[model samples]
Target: MGDGPVTRETTKSAADDIRVDQWAGGVRRITITRPTLRNAYRSQTAVEIAAAIEQFTADDADQVLVITGAGGAFCAGGDLTSSYESTHADAVQLGHGVVIREGMHRVMRALALCDKPVIAMISGPAVAGGLALALACDLRIGDDTARLGDTSGMVGLLPDEGGAWLFPRAMGTDHALRMLWGCELYDAQQALELGLLTQVVPAAELESAVLALATRITRTAPLTTRVVKRMVRNAMSQSLHASLIEAEYAVAAINDTADVREGIAAFLDKRTPRFVGR
Candidate 1:
């Protein structure tokens, strides 16, 4: 969570490369603004995105996060052919993987630590590190024009930004390896079949669909949502017995919250429950 100053601004800010905005239904949206190169992010762009994610993680009022790109495209990944050396010259010395460690790695770390749910709103191409970024999120909603793939080998760079670990898990090891080796790109429907996307809508309806999804999530119990995100992600690697034990612990902590009482009372009364994040 971010320890820096965080405020709930009523308006959206787009002065920087990454636009951060807090919307109704307690949703925070982060948009990469470099749409010319299909939103191919540089080091500064990664830093800004990481900061936005951390801020969302820290803010109490924000219930869900929506990450997307401006224009028609999603992120095209990091610019491998750019002047990365000049950008990193001021920060750290050149060494084994120092560039990514200081740049996009911060984003991966932030995403991993975030207890809140993240939704990747993918529109156009989301390849390479961009694909990894989307995979890190709890859910991915894409449009029909959406594209996903790995082009790391073509540029002689590995998916150093969490793709190496996330790709194999999203779509089995064999399929992930096949796509990686072939530098394959898939359309939204194909990505959905491969388990990369949760849902795919038409380009025109993408915004409304994503907004509806976020609003639906915001109506859920906030504390339960965060805990469920963590527990489910951890359960992927945990045994059934261990997961049960973890669930017991979670229940123990959550049963005492005022929201639980509100939920039970609302159920008996046949009314909507008002949760205050207690």
Candidate 2:
């Protein structure tokens, strides 16, 4: 989006939760805004976020997605009041699982399925479902002002919003259960130590640092970035032998991309490479 369209879809309340901004170098940032609720999402908010992610999935013009929130908080979790609202005419006839499966669960799936990179910019509390949202991202950049953990159990709830699986995978079952059961909230430093955050910075530098990283990613070969992301995710559940075989084929295909040729040419010419996502 360095020299492309710039758009801002801003609206108050859950009617429109998505505020999409185009930064330089094909970086598309989506800011979730629900200031009255500490950015806590309802059914409509999750739907909008999921829709934005699905749009990003196909839009080649966008190379990266930065997900953050307006105000101080990243997200507080799902809005409990609306979590079980069946009075709405559009409400599903099915039970509780369907509500979540269609709401935040869809948002989780969208983030997981997105080919482009998703980075979380955590400013304040990111607990319960909010933690799941952050963990779903490819990377999370936080500041000392932030708090991270699972507090769903305190309210007699569970990590139904992707945390059930994402938490364990990120910090192992023991740590995940400890946090979930204990309803613990950790500071930014503790979150970093627990592998919940990629990096932490001063509150003043949080935005700049995350944007800088996103920009750096945009400068890399797009094909390489996508392929590497896929390969690594696949390797997590695959055997070493299977992973190696996949890498063999992946390298062969990557070497043939036009971006690879451009990279080689740039190296030979002693110049910065310009990748076109070919």
Candidate 3:
């Protein structure tokens, strides 16, 4: 799939609270629009996010997916007040657990299963389930003003929405355990040092930095890019020998693409190659 403009028929419905924007260079930006509650994920919001992610993966024109929050904050977490039940006092503990499993878990899984590259654009606080959402992305670009943490322990709760699994994988088990247990928050610089963020920029330059990186990624052949994402994700669980075999097969498939020939020819000619993602 090649990068191009999105058509009306391919566009998703606007009824979802999340804002979906497909840019010219294959970047699909999904913005959480709720800022008053710090963009917390209600059951409906989680469903919308899951749907947007699925649409992004299915759209050939969308090569990269960027998940961001509107206003100053990224997300506060799951909106405890926005449950389907009439009131929190009337809701059973089992019902609350089911909501987390069915709503937030689905959103996190969608991001994890996406074949294309996914980036989390964090400009402010990403706490609790919000932290889990950011961790699900393949890469994270955060502003210096951003804060990251898992505050579930503070409220006598567990990180049920992929946090227990994702946090340990991103930041080591020791660091993840400390954060979860102490309910500590890390500044953007600390997050970068701890490997939670791929890069940190000034708040004013966050969008530019993210766009630049996405543009660079979109310059590569689409098939190669998608294959690399899948292979690396699989490598986390696969044995080294198995990963090597997978890489060999991936290389063979990529070699058969027209973009490979163009890439080589352009290199020999000392010119910028134009890849159509063939």
Candidate 4:
């Protein structure tokens, strides 16, 4: 990844509903472009988002992925018109559940399991499934205008796409319960205090802040970064003993990389190391 923006083959689905931009320093930005809908995604849009994330993970040049929305709002959640009402009349009772489980849930799972670091850049509301999507990322940066919460309760729905699991893990069981039960929406500062946001900046500074963080991450050795991401995510579910065992394997693997040698040499030589992601 160079310092300049790089061109890559853009997928048709991504071009239409999602937009993928590869910036220098191994950062790939995936933007949800349905601004008129406040970035609300239908089932098909969720599939396109999953596809873009899959591409980012497989692209060797990409080390960090930043997910955001165009026209201010991050995401308003699933497109109810396309997902529920239109299909509800024609679909069996279970069909609605099936559609969500196979569609948006898969997108959330992809974000959660991505080996590379994923960051959510939230400039506006991240409601319901949209909040779940943001929670799936490894880190979240929000702007002052940002508002986040689970809005499903208002509509007599549950946070079906990993919100129940992710919210509790991120903000503890009690806080998660309150938010879900009350449909409590928090402003950017409140979200930061609740540990929902990694950092919050003025609206105008959000992009620069996200870019600075991404740049810092890309300067590290790629192999180590990926390994660390995997290890930490695994630790969330794995027992301490199992996590240690996995870390042992990861350490051995990373120790063998040329980047490790360069890191050691750089320390001894008292100079900044240039990593080629070897």
The model with the greatest TM-score is 4
What are the runs in model 3 whose C-alpha is more than 4 Å off? 1-15, 84-90
**TM-score list, all predictions:** 0.91, 0.92, 0.91, 0.93
Q: Give all candidates' CA lDDT scores.
A: 0.86, 0.86, 0.85, 0.86
For candidate 1, what is the lDDT? 0.86
* lDDT per residue (tens digit) for residues 145-207 in model 4: 999998788877888888988999989999999999999999999999998999998888888
Which of the two candidates, 1 or 2, achieves a greater TM-score against the reference? 2
What's the distance in Å from true for residue 2, model 3?
22
Candidate 2 residue-wise lDDT at 264: 98
lDDT of 1 by residue, 1-278 (tens): 12222334443455577877765558888988888889988878888889888988998888989899999888999875563633465442454266687678999999999999899999999999899999999899999999999987886767788999999999999999999999999999999999999999888888778877887888888999999998998899999999999999999999999999999999999999999998
- Mind sharing the TM-score for model 1? 0.91
lDDT by residue (tens digit), candidate 2, 1-278 = 22233455433354577677675557788788886788888887888889888988898987888999889899999887666742453553446677788889999999978877999999898989899999999999999999999888877877889899999998889999999989999999999999999999999888778878888898999989999999988899999999999999999999999999999999999999989988
Poorest 10 consecutive residues by lDDT, candidate 2? 1-10
Model 2 TM-score, all chains together: 0.92
User: Which residue pairs show collisions in model 2?
Assistant: 1-26
